[model samples]
Target: MPRNSDLTPDKALAVKWINDNVAQLSRDHMTIWNLHEPSWREYKSSAWYVERLRAEGFDVEAGSGEMPTAFAAVWSNGDGPTIGGYAEYDAVPGASQDPVPRRQPRVGVNRHAAGHTDPHSALGMGSFTGFLAAKHVMERHGIKGRLKFFGEPAEKMCGSKPVHAAKGYYNDLDAAISFHPHSFPRLANSCFWDTHSAPYWSRIYTFECDNPETWQNAGAVTGVAHGHSAARAPGAIDAVCLMYTSSKYMKESMLPHHGSWSLNEFILHAGQAAADNIAPGLAQIQYSLRAPTLDMCARVFEVLDRNAEHCAAMTHSKVTANWITRTRAGLANHAMAEVTWRNFEAIGAPQWDEKARSFAREIQASLDIPPMEDPFTPEIQHLTAPWDGEKAFREQLPSWQTNLAADDYVDYTWHAPTVRLYVGRPTLRAPNPGYRYPEWTRHAMGGVPACIDPMWLTAGKVIATTILDLLSDGVSLDKAKSEFRERTGGGIGGTSWIAPLLPADFAPPVHYRWPEYVTTVRGQEWTIPTAAP
Candidate 1:
């Protein structure tokens, strides 16, 4: 913490203001959660945030990163330093669950539609409320600084931010601050994540089966000795299957499994299935890979590219890899973390009242778990270091490990001083002799305000205070920048720095077949919900 200056009155007022307005904030959070749009298709969700930010007197760029749903909202007061925060609104595909104790899917819709399992509803809420709270304090106190809240959509696909970074969105900002709802032991309600994670590369490889004659009868003709019937050539579907299975077979040989690298395949449907024994003309497969280092990721991609080529050849098709989302490893800054942690200790844990406890017990009892006076752990209401995780990462990899998981928010670390503050959203718990709480129970808790509002309010306090510090104290900002410069050897163009992985001219994969809600004259539904009317 910076030399213990007395708590700024304006900052105190800002925290109070946010606490008083938690009810309104909770309503907004539930609204977004109910939308539950996935990936690049968070149209309603993005528009709602943009409209809310504008109503709070922010200048919003509705579509900033060449992505339709991606946006940035700006508010400033004569600009001493420009600080940034962002919100991720995209839900995951096939994770549908309503906020109920028992097993429940989207009512009158899909049982496997997109839902905010990461509970991004609360994640986006904390960040956005922080933005508003900071705006309130700065405006009231006449604080001289610039602030921006980015409407980052498609985070589930790791989309948008890299495009923003490459296009010079975060260039003028002094620092970027972000927070997430984490369940990792000791990481909850504490503002600490130094040895964070590395880059995750997501790309789509498309295979086109244009020529059928070559595979079936390159040596024979349609009306030749084969009697007008040409032996069938394996099509794009065959090629996709070959590529998928081949990568699975080659995965063990691809990496040494030392640094926690993984690659996953997703087949995309982009063409009509041919009939009359004709070869399929088009098929696509996406691969999202995470690695501790860029070199490791590169080596794995090379093997994948080669496998795609061979798979295409075997099925008489052509393939191309379309780069979608690419993020670099996180750059850690202890100075920023220290400031945020100091605020975390000040705010203490979220106060889970008796009402919340009863609701949690209700969910637990539905699952046949005996309810205790406290089903949820009281420890989560306090601050703790992520000791176990930090130790495991150290033991599993080099002590200098920087990245361990996959997230596009890590992109901010590469550009400027970025800090990730973690807080615990409410999670359902099971006692001894009982199994873990079902995912729906957790989802149920996440949607309820009594459970998640504490997280949102506490996170908002940390964010508001941190931004207040940067605005009120130049020394803190300088310390953060100094750490950033030393870490990057001079920053963005520094000798030891990493550049944006996705090219500036690269195209986003918006045209591909991503899972989205399908609307028709029969009303609305998610992905043509596989349920009877």
Candidate 2:
């Protein structure tokens, strides 16, 4: 593995740039965190990045691939390999919390309003920091290459990246880098090895009740037509309920209860009438499926479609299915992984100071557990080898399962040589074996500057160094590309290669009634009211 001493003049400059701009990066992260925008509705968050990237000399195309909250930005130094990196800024609903240790929702919003959990706030700014640092170095040293920075929204649903891939946005890239804050101990401070992420497929089913009056009952020819005299048809609301219930019942049969797989549903909208017996006009339910193989996702989706059909027919409504995203399982690139790992080793892991530890102890004390001298998880402050991380990651999975959870970054693997780098986020040490910390603890730690900055700063350094290395080291870049080609049967269109699940003309489902904050007579708030009932 390469040591820190191996960093060339340009790579050293990149690291120094990031170090100098730490304060600005932190402010950017906090700005996005405060915005707290959700999937498909990252209006402010996306716009902020757009303005920022354009100011940095990138020719940015706003709303790329017809997704309103996605952007593609590029800066080039003549003709050379185009290296791609991206940022995700969308937050999650019901994760709202203040930066304080105790449980307190962010002010001026509902208790359940959107907030950063895995905290894309840091996830995004970390990559953005690295991109800017590398750009600075390239300009100062006259390095030759292209940098592609993408604004990817709605990643919580595993959205956007697949659409970007299908629309040929990533087609020109020679290499790509993906970064995520380590949410699990086994995967902290390492790059993926043999095992990567599984496939994720999401679709929204809309049920519309166009003509509830045309149901199988006739109205009597009475002189006075009483309101109660007519038979009322069950509306979209009933259809959605049936769809939800039926899917829950059939989830067990969707696939064998063996591998690491999941089927989750979210009700995007359930319309209803006030003070009347009229049927609801529209309802929407989204289902996201994650499993080890494309075949597994297909089987599960087939069952869901069958259930939706039955539910729609029973409730006198018509249902339509729209694709949100369909991503292939991850393709491993050991050579790319090695390149990233070497850079990570050189940067070392995040080092939390006494101030960060003091805040952690406050959290433990709030939870009524005795705070130790070192309250953070061991992995957060140390490095782990990719092979070692993979062994620990595979311990809970069946031997046959090649992939674990799901992430949209896997979509980039098929397009070019890609590496998914993991840096440790702040996590508390468990009080006892099998004991889990409260959700608020993680959320609070994420917002605290002292706690979260270490992780993202380390991530920025590692990514900058790696990008600089790939740009200067032809041998390393070629080795990674060779591995990518061998894995995908000669890159992209080989016999064993898998084409994008979405077609080039596939339309993104941004029109769905996704959850978002709204401004009304009551001012800005989540769709749900914040006042006490």
Candidate 3:
């Protein structure tokens, strides 16, 4: 715990405001958890944030960058540095769970309806609580600076940040703070050091059999009768199946299998209906690649394109590819990491009281395992140094690979000095060696206020303090900027700097058939129908 005398008056005010508003954070988190909007369609969640920020005296632009679910909110206290942070409200598909100890889907929704997996509900509220608390302190102290909070949806697809960066939404910031729930054990309660996130590139392939009538060996009969009687072309469904298998075979050869690279595909539209003689005309599949470098991503993409081409040719379909997102690898700023780490130490790691432990024990008992007295993992209640986390993060990687995993936050690091902060959310300890807990344990813990508030509330104080420090402590901010310039060869658009991978005029992939809730004659349900036809 930080002593009251250790903090300056402004910092104290920021901390106190966050402590007082804990109920508000809890309310907002539960509301978003219940909303559970998925990627590319966070309509209600986005509007809620926009309205709340506007009510809090910020100028908010809803539907930012031609993406209907994105927004930018800015509040300024006269002329000073501009600090940036964001909130992600988008949930993952197939993770729906109620805030209970056992397996139960959220009431009144499809069992497969989207749910807050990492519980971005807490992520958004934590950063939001910090931003608002900082704003309150700035107002009370007459501090001079600007605070920018962005409503970033579709993060599960790595969707919105690259678009925002390409369109210049992040260009004006002096620094940025990125926060996440500590989903990994190695990263608990620390800021990222040298090994930041890798690059993620996603693309969709569409195959069409529009010219099946012109296939070589079809009978001489005309359009309608020929389609049913003549030998039919293999068509788009075959193309999609072949593409999927071919890519699976080629994935091993995409790289040397050295670094932590991955290639995964999602079948968006299978294009098959009730069995009829006419061939299925259209199919679409999406490929998402994550690798340590852009060259690796490019090589994987080349093989995918070749597979698509061969599948289309063999199946007598024509294929076209569209980009979903292209993101750059992360560049680290040590100074920014250092600044955030000091603030984290002052705030201390989150403490789980007996109430939280009781919930974990209940979850364990429900899972048929006897619970320990302290059911939570040690890391959740303690802090890890940034350097230590970096070392642990690199355990599986080869010596030369610097970045690991993929996140859109990497885009922000190129724009300004950015720090990725992780505060531990609730996690239960394994009862025996190699025994894994079910997914509901995590989702349940994330939603329960008794279990989850400590993480977000601590995150709130850390972010508020860091924002105030950057606003008032010009020397520290300058050091961070200097490191960013040195790392990027002079900062944004310098000799070694990496620009936004997407073009300014690049269209957002809102038209894609992403999984979302729909209102049918039956009722509101997942695009995947709740009942059999």
Best by lDDT: 3
Q: Candidate 2, which ten residues in sequence have the lowest lDDT sum?
A: 216-225
Higher lDDT: candidate 1 or 3?
3
Regions of candidate 2 where Cα sits further than 4 Å from its true position: 1-4, 221-223
User: Tens digits of per-residue lDDT for model 2 on 442-532?
Assistant: 8998888999998888888888888888888777789999988898888978877898899999988888778898888888878888774
Q: What's the CA error at residue 328 for candidate 2, in Å?
A: 0.6
Model 1 weakest 10-residue run by lDDT: 1-10
TM-score (C-alpha) between model 3 and the true structure: 0.97
Candidates in descending lDDT order: 3, 2, 1
lDDT of 1 by residue, 1-533 (tens): 11224356766777787878988898999999999998889999999988988888889999886788889888879958899999888888767887777788778777778888878888899988887888888888889999988988888777988888888788888988989887564566664456776788888899998877767544554445452366667888888898888899999999885667778878777457645456678989999998988888888899999999999988888998888888888888878887877776666677788888888888878877788787777556667754444654566566655677778888888777888888877765548646666677777777777877888778888888888888787688899998888988898888878888877776667777888888877778777555754
- Give the alpha-carbon lDDT of every model: 0.80, 0.89, 0.90
Instruction: Tell me the lDDT of model 1 at 294.
Output: 85
lDDT of 2 at 267: 92
